[model samples]
Target chain A: MSLAPSERPGTHPDDSNLSATYALVLVVEVIVILGLYWIGRQFG
Target chain B: MQWIDWAIVAVYLFWIVWTGLRMGRKTEELESYFLANRSLPWWAVGLSVMATQLSAITLVGTTGQGYNAGLSFIQFYFGLPLAMIILSLTVVPLFRRANIYTAYEYLERRFDSKTRLFTSLLFLLSRAMATGVVIAAPSVILSVIFGWNLTLTILAFGIPTIFYTMKGGVQAVTWADVKQMVVIVGGLSAAAVALIMGLPDDVTVGAALRTAGAVGKMQALDFTFDTSTTYTFWSGLIGGLFLSMSYFGCDQSQVQRYLTAKSVDEARGSLLMSAFWKIPLQVLVLMVGVLMFVFFLFNQGPILFKNTYLPAVQSSTRAAEYAGLDREYAQAFENRKLAARAMAAAQADGAPAGAASFARSEFVRNDTAVREVRAKATALVKDVTGDPDYNDTNYVFPTFVTEHLPVGLVGLIIAAIFAAAMSTIAAELSSLATSSVIDIYRRHLKPEADDAHYVTVSKWATLFWGLFACFVATFAAEMGSLIEAVNVLGSYFYGSILGVFILALGVKRANGDGAFVGLIAGMSAVWWVDQHTATVYLWLNVVGAVVVTVVGTIVSLLTGGATAGPDAGKSAATRAA
Candidate 1:
């Protein structure tokens, strides 16, 4: 059987978008964590 | 435990069984059974992955770790995100593209059958034994709390899981895991909230945290560069990264989680989800433990958390000694609580010299008492159980749940613990069955078998492994601290397996012979280091991976390359004949 389309050897079709999305998620995660830390410090 | 608790647990079991039975129709074919037809969404796959890793032991034992040892353990997951990002870029895509049922199947194509077989066998040995321990951990806790036989407890958890897994396969495993994750997370959150409410009125969340911080429980980051220390920031970042990579990248249990993703991007996303959430999740679990520690400060808790061991001590000749030690422990805790309160008050009102000195003296005395009781408990356990290494770490959360949690919530928390255990057990059994059927049985014994035949065999394999895990669980009591047992087992083989995978991808010249020899050598070296060196076990993953790659590459260079092609040709010819 042939391999799945997304598993093919060429560059991923959504590589750029995926990377950008992932980067954004990472940034947002960090910001949220920092925000929580700040909040903990203030109210804590 | 009340009727409501039993009802909740009963309902949970019924729902799980029903979910499994529902997936039976979809599991008629091998592909559907093993890979869910590679048609899962990223979110489901992601949750399954997390559920598989965050077992019941983690919920109970990790919180206990936080309560006892502090937050330094959180550093152990520091490298997880990096490992996930790296794997997403590398092995994940390759495995998806190859459309291989097992990771070892790719090894045969890239190197030789022998290399594939060796690595797969190593995986089976480790995962099977580890799965048994996973089953045992929750079983022991349940048995202790409910006064059931441990062996019966093991079967109680193991049997239903086997039936569901055998009936529904990957589809059942994944969806069941989703429900299990919900129970686990919900239960933990509920427990945390209940704990906070149960605390004395003066013990606000902030005050609890401050107390925990004063006792070093809140020290999440330790920048010390000690290779010998297991949970330092540097060790965690470097060693933890290697361990996570080996676990997620090479271990079939985790690989199977991502393999079911709908696309390469989805698989990467699923892994990234784990990477992002693991540390924070661990932090939350540890925080629960820290809260529990603070709760104890305000309340009188058992001098020895292991009540089972306590009774054993009372029955022993050292009963008086134990009783005396218990009194000392009580006094010490009282003093410590006073010190902790003083420290909290001091910190609140700007630390005064007198308050600081009082807190310091109390802290020292309380710590001494804690150690003294622990020593007595350890000695008593050795006398009773005939094992000196028996530690009370695993008992910490279970004791809290049984003693403190309200009736209905206790049942939910217990169900949650079962969810954790079953989730990990299901994933491990599924992967074990997949590796056995795909890598060995299907490829060698019956290459021309239809999907139905393969499906039947897969179900049987799942059942077989489940039984094997149950049997192993019987002996798991001898193993100390379920968390440490799992990690030690992983370290024994993970590095070498990861090394072989690296060799497969990076060094084209590394033929099967080289890979095979290098793998053995890598494992041997890891064993040697474990025996002779003082390095933390987690770092062994790094050492093993590096050694396997370096040694495999060298062996490949020494032996002329391309032996794998001829080897596969011979195997094909033998099959044809």
Candidate 2:
């Protein structure tokens, strides 16, 4: 018998919504890293 | 170390082991043992995911990388968040819907048992070999710091980790990992803060950064189109993406982490957690090392951080020569300190660009002379020890921890190091046992075993792999060349393994025969590139996955596609004859 998926704590949104959010998250992170790089270059 | 520090470490170990054992008491079936009944919350699994990736070497070594070479090393993780998003959309839901115990089990449903067994064996072999290095790495620090026997050190780390993982299974491993993540992060955060506060009064935070920036330590981006550079933006994004994809998508250790989450959404959330926090976390750890670099400028830093060869240098025929070099190093260090102070003052004044520029060049000249003296000392020590590549990057953080950090904090950081080591080893041991049972024993050795029987066998598998890791680690201490060979050989297989997964997921035309052949071709291509070209190692993953998919798809098309749908073969039930 397959173990049933337990009820989630409702903390996370659905996968479709979360997937898009994560994609956005990655884009934001890349920007942050780039910002850090530019700032480091300026101070450097 | 002080008694207070020893007390903190001892208490932490006791609590961690007890908590792990307590969590495992209810794990009576394979589902509970391996997947935590798919009932774990997203946050627990998320922290475990982070903890598993933040191994001891990463904690110590990456910080050392920050100290030695600036934040350019952070680029190595540029692909990680992207990889996580891809896995979230693709493999996370795919594995959840299939309801498989191991990732290779899904390969069997899509391909054939031979494909399943071949890939699983690769996982077992590579992971088992890598686990040895994982345990050996921190044990080296313990041995040096505590003056303990290396074999005993191996056992000290391996034995408790083995027992808890063997008894508690994934539940124990996951919970222990969550707690470990806390300690690891807390210790690192505390260390970073302390290092900043510990800096001399004259060197303001901005000044320290300017000092670091002036030395090219803070330069994080390199936009050069050169393929030969190790940590370029392109290499990190492309190469790191491929490596992260294979690791998160295909490798059972990581696959198993997300699989334990309550639902596909939670699994994706766990990975997303890593994606969001990983770069910033890396920057913080690297910042600690950068701050340490500034701390050493004003303080009298060691000429050679690894002091193992001090007695030998003092007693050797070249003792006076070493002493003269030490005196020269002191003079250069003082000159560099004055130059650094001048540069910091000039930068604050907004004076003509040439003043700061001159101070920077003067500081650099003195710094280069000091490094030259240290290089000569390193060579002399290497000659005395007869180990050619005796660099001390790994020793730098531990040396700093002992010498500088306050008493209770030192113990806390040391415990965090142990936590990092245990968390990784636990996850590895858990996944190794899972693959061994789900992919091999149940599929081949005994397909009809009852739940109790399989669970018992799973425990035995965990114990066996744990012992095996310890065995390899013991020998690894004696044979350095073998460890290198094992690491190189492991890298050779990852791209091929990742390739087969890509075929399984993306290429509908791929049959068992095509995938099997494509895997071999991919391995061959990677080996060929490694032997013939100067292509950086990160690119090998991309090449391997692409070669497998292209070759496998071509072969499948040439052989005529889709004779059957999903149930392509049932010979997986039969043993190889």
Candidate 3:
């Protein structure tokens, strides 16, 4: 029997939501990188 | 060291052994032994995940990095949280649903058997050698500090780990890892606090930061677009993203961590927990090193931290030359310290221009002296050891630990180091055994074997890999940084493995032969890139995964001749074959 999408243990339900989360995470990561760069330029 | 320090270490070791022995009863079955019956709490799994990642090399080498280089190293982990979050939504759930013993097993189901076997073998080869190096890292430091034999130090820490892991399997490994993580964080946090408190009364934490900032030690990021550089923002984001994805997604060592979680949500939650904490935690760890750099500025710091090379230089005929240089270095440091204090006082007195000018000259003089001492030390070491590979950047924290921390705390910290080493060693060995027996032996050689028989063989496999790691640990001293060596080795293969998984998941048309060929091509491409390009090793993941997926898909289209229907039975038979 094919496993239902929701019944499947590890897979999240919505791809769009997952993509949005990923984009959000990428944004945060960029900010962190930029922040570190600013700090390095100022202090280093 | 005091008796209290020994007592703390003794108690910690005793508890570890007890925990391992206690968990032994639950390890009789293969599933329970390998995956803790998939019943672990998120907290335990989370802590275990963090513990496995933070080895003794991190505790010592990273602190040493901070002591010398400042906080730039923290940028290396910026991609980790993003990687973790991405994996949670994709591979974490998929692997849990597949219900496989190893991550490699999923490659067979999704792509082909050869892909699975190739990836599993890569993991074994990398992790086995890496385990030896990991064990040897702390042992080298201990031997240097205590004047003990290296082989004895390896055995002292490695043997107990083997006993528990071979006895209790993943149950012992996960529980021990939880405790080890606690001790490691406690030891590091304690060290940071002590270093801060121990600074000169005249220097506030703010002033120390200002000094470190002034000296360019507080540089935490590099936004330059240089593929050749190891820790730039782009390299960290793109290269680090792929590396983290491949590591957390496909590598069995980490895959096995989440597999033990009670449910998919728990596993994803546990991984997310690591995602959330990884960057900040690394920042804290590296900050300890930066603070130590500040500490050394106010206090009298050693000209050369690794004392092992000092004796060799003294014994050489050029000893007089080295001694003269050392005398000059000491006098230079004295003058620089006086100048630094005067500059600080001048700044306090609102003489900005005078303070700036004095600080500028003092900085140059101090930096010149530091470079001269380093060059002298390196040359002397080369002369004495006859091995040009001796670098003392990795030796900084061990020197600090042995020389600075109080007696009782010293033993606790030492035990924490042992805890970190043993946790990683135990996990790698256990996962190695699981992959070997379940993915290879049980699938091909003994398909009809009973649980009891498989369990017996698994224990034996664990013992075998453990013994092999200890044997390898004897030679690990030749490697410079155990942490860097492990990742470099992983870079050679992790990208290719991640590629196979991507093909299996995203490309439905990709057949077994295509995957098998693509896997080889992927590894070859990565090796070529590594040999030819100036790109950082972390970027190998992106190169390998993308190459394998794109190549594997094209090869599958050419070979399979436009077959569009899902070939589930064909895929299964290919795996069975």
Candidate 4:
């Protein structure tokens, strides 16, 4: 698997990009959590 | 408890200790003692990470939650995978490259000794107290079931874990955790299967699921944005992310688990493993509780799940009142069971489904009446015992196991509980020792000590903290629910710790004094909100982290930016020290 340019060893993102990463992951997690909520509603 | 069950538990205890001890010979230095020589594979570290987080609270208290409230409590974990990903991209790489024995050691490199010591002490305080509660929870069930005293139960589980952790160090904790995770998963799976099998032959799994759903026990999500509520989807995802970040990123107990990996990528892999498995695992554990709820529908469950309280109420002056309530509860149970069976039959017969819906409503009414009577019985038991805050949610699964499960399976479940408790307690003891010695003893008091001397001191620290945890366990029974108490206790400090770390890692101008005062400010803000507002505890993590970062940044600017130097403390001497 190819590594993201920012994800390679010794190549961390700058402060702005790192902050963006945090926001991006948060949005992704919230979406997945909503998916879990969907599963519970459907199966429950 | 049967002899066969006792024998299974005994063998499990012996096997874990032996496995731990066999790894002890690998520890020849401080690095090896704490990080397993950084030679561990990602999968082993991943399993250990998962096991350490899946404590007795998850096994017992969470299942109790499922039985009491349903799958809604699972929203509390929605932030975990996100937190794991964040940690993988950020702190895991930072800590691995820093070559530190404890996460707080990196704080010193970034800020100052005072900052490191303060955050490290906070971790020691919260984790040490939480460990007591962790060990206390399962011991309550074991003592009640086996007729042993609580102290004896605590020690029986505590001593071996402390011994193995002190002797074998991280290597032992890691491998033991791997096996313990397997045992925990297997044991819970067995109990789930047993519960389904124990249901009347006519009640198929799908029928049981429908029955559970009909009673509102299956609704797992709540999107309503209510700050006062505890387990809504928003609170779980946002607040839970902050909690998970504090726990997996900043807490040494969890951070140390992943730090044993061979490289930064491996460490990240270890956390991602948790991201993938944690929610599914929690779903299964809570499913066991949901299944138990279904099982008890056909069976006659006790008026109070806590049997100790039953005896107390029986012997109290309110015995006649209690006896009356008990009869009512039994009758209600019968009515509820018949209604549930009728609903199942109607659904199977391809009727209009109206009759099934009516029967569901009738069953719910009877179940509600039974619960009201049980509440009165609990109140009476509390008055007689002079113990307020008595809740029996933690006792639900354990009582079902002891009273209902087949003999061999009972032992396996009990053994799994032991594994769950021991895995968490061992990790706490080991991490407590690491921070105490690496962050305090070696860094401050004995900075020039040889590796042999530091290793010996670390072992002694483990024993001291182990004893401290046992003492704390004695008072833990009064706490309402073990899982909530531990998490609430964590929320009190975790946000502030995470805030301090964020300042250390993300903000270039953040100085030690700023980090220090900001942490206190963050904690005080959380305490104020906890006391004065109706905000749920999960949000406290977010509150604390934000308070720390904002307060720390403002304080830093006021104090003349970056007191140590331009690059903070990342000098060759400090980095290589």
Ranking by lDDT: 4, 2, 1, 3
A best-first ranking of the candidates according to their DockQ comes to: 3, 2, 1, 4
TM-score for each predicted model, relative to the true structure: 0.92, 0.94, 0.92, 0.93
Tens digit of lDDT per residue, candidate 1, span B387-494?
A: 666666777788888888888998899899989988899999999999999888987898887888889888899999999999988888546665466667679799
Give candidate 1's whole-model lDDT.
0.80
In candidate 3, stretches whose alpha carbon ends up further than 4 angstroms from where it belongs are A1-44, B346-357, B478-487, B561-577
What TM-score does chain B get in every candidate?
0.94, 0.95, 0.94, 0.97
Return model 4's CA RMSD, one decimal: 4.0
lDDT of 2 by residue, B1-577 (tens): 8999989889888888998999989988888999998888889999999899888988888888888897888888889999898888788887865667888987777777788889999899999999998888878767876677999989978998999999999999999999999999999999989888887776688888888887789998877755567788888888889888888889898999989999888898999898888888899888888888887788777788767678877888888888888898898889888887877777776578788778788877877776788898888888777777677777778888998888999999999998999999999999999999888888788988777898899999999999999998887766657667776776688878888988877776777788888999999998998889887778888788889989988887888753332433433222211
What are the per-residue Cα lDDT tens digits for candidate 4 across B456-555?
9989999999999988887785455654666676788998999998887677788888899999999999999998999999899999999999999999
Candidate ranking (TM-score, best to worst): 2, 4, 3, 1
lDDT of each: 0.80, 0.83, 0.78, 0.84
Collision count for each candidate, in order: 0, 0, 2, 0
lDDT of 3: 0.78
Error of 2 at B189 (Å): 0.7
